[model samples]
Target: MPAHFRQERTKIVVTADNEVNIQTLTNWKVSVPFLVMLSDSSNITMPITIEDTLNQCFTQETTEQIIHLSPVCANLLRRVTASDPPFKLISVTPSPVGESGEARCIIQGKGIVSLEAVNQLGEHFLLATTYLSVGEYGIHFSTENLANGVYGIILRAADGREQRSVIVIER
Candidate 1:
């Protein structure tokens, strides 16, 4: 199992245009779900922190059931809907960039612009930019130029909607 699938939901703090403090994956299609706060929404005010529930989707009926079970979970689902977690990945066959079984990752979303991987101590890995696509970003993630164990992912949106999420980069 991957931390993105379990572990404490990545914490996203929405400050007053102040700055998104860090912390934090991809692909053989690893899903990095994030509930981002859009700047265009009239209903959104600043300084609101959104925690937990990344890359989660639920229909209205399902949402109702979740609410019945746990109001906290239901509220998270609603927040995730407002900013919609990135894409579940359209598709990737035999490595998006690296050779077959080369441990590749692709973080695809409309607003995601930059991607970074960090280790347990918040140390960043020196990533090679060769595999990066023009629009659809791809990373040839590995344990060499990067760390071995699981790390945190820091993804920033072009619209200034920043999010923090967990990812398991296993060799």
Candidate 2:
């Protein structure tokens, strides 16, 4: 997998024209989520950092706070907090458009799985349904004589978990 890094910073300032405006500054709150990826293919999510700076000008007080992520160290955080299942469907890459030649469907997963192909009307066609061990696996299917429409590639794990992806076959 490719690696990605990103850094972001946000600053907020408040000014007081009278006493009432200054009191509202104390009620301000901020929250941020930072993504950190680990070597073991895991991720951590937390707040980066917050810095507060107060400056006194002529007769008014200016308060500024900066929230930023450190560029030196970070990780890839998962967008969803839901726990991952033992068998994960990483991806299903199919040839987007193709002619009457051979079109392929690549199913990637973590554990044992069985794959099948279905039409747009939810009709299951037994393409390749066999138990695959724990790792990444790929299977190739022909598009010859098939209609020019969308077909669904469904992968079922040994534990009964299933993932579906669609591929378009064009004449």
Candidate 3:
């Protein structure tokens, strides 16, 4: 017998009629909207087990794809470093690229701060919180396996100041 996991309005169940195995097939059809809505409505988060089925129902659809927006003061000096000097994002390159590629950028300005990459929702996709040495700095990122989308590089200095740079990626 197939069992279904349900909570509230969401219904998740495993059926014996589902495609079991096929070495000749190349693709399988799935309903994204239904899955998302069902998953959302249910309390089941992930790592679901399909009892009696060898293959688990693992899906990457819930993965987040974000667009990073550049902050207004990305190029402005916001805080001074330990040397009491101002800091800012001088320049960044390869503004956009596929997620399976690399993007390089250089930041020039006085004083040193922290740096990172953030999504459109202002969430840190990649955090480079380490303190930088004074003077110009260059940051190289390798998003070889990251989700295809847009992101922003955020930088902060010793004086608790911050900056942002834009980056876009596609599959």
Best by TM-score: 2
CA-lDDT, candidates in order: 0.33, 0.40, 0.39
How far residue 16's Cα lies from its native spot in candidate 1, in Å, is: 37
Residue-by-residue lDDT tens digits, candidate 2, 60-134: 132532222322222232234312224444555645635422222223343544566678787776555555554
Q: Compared with the true structure, what per-residue lDDT tens digits does model 3 show for residues 50-165?
A: 33232223322223321111222122222211222234565556556544323233333435445566766766655444445544556555565455566666656544445545
Model 3 residue 11 lDDT score: 25
lDDT of 3: 0.39
Please give the range of 10 consecutive residues that has the lowest summed lDDT in model 3. Answer: 33-42
Ranking by TM-score: 2, 3, 1
Clashing pairs in 3: 67-120, 68-150, 113-157, 114-156
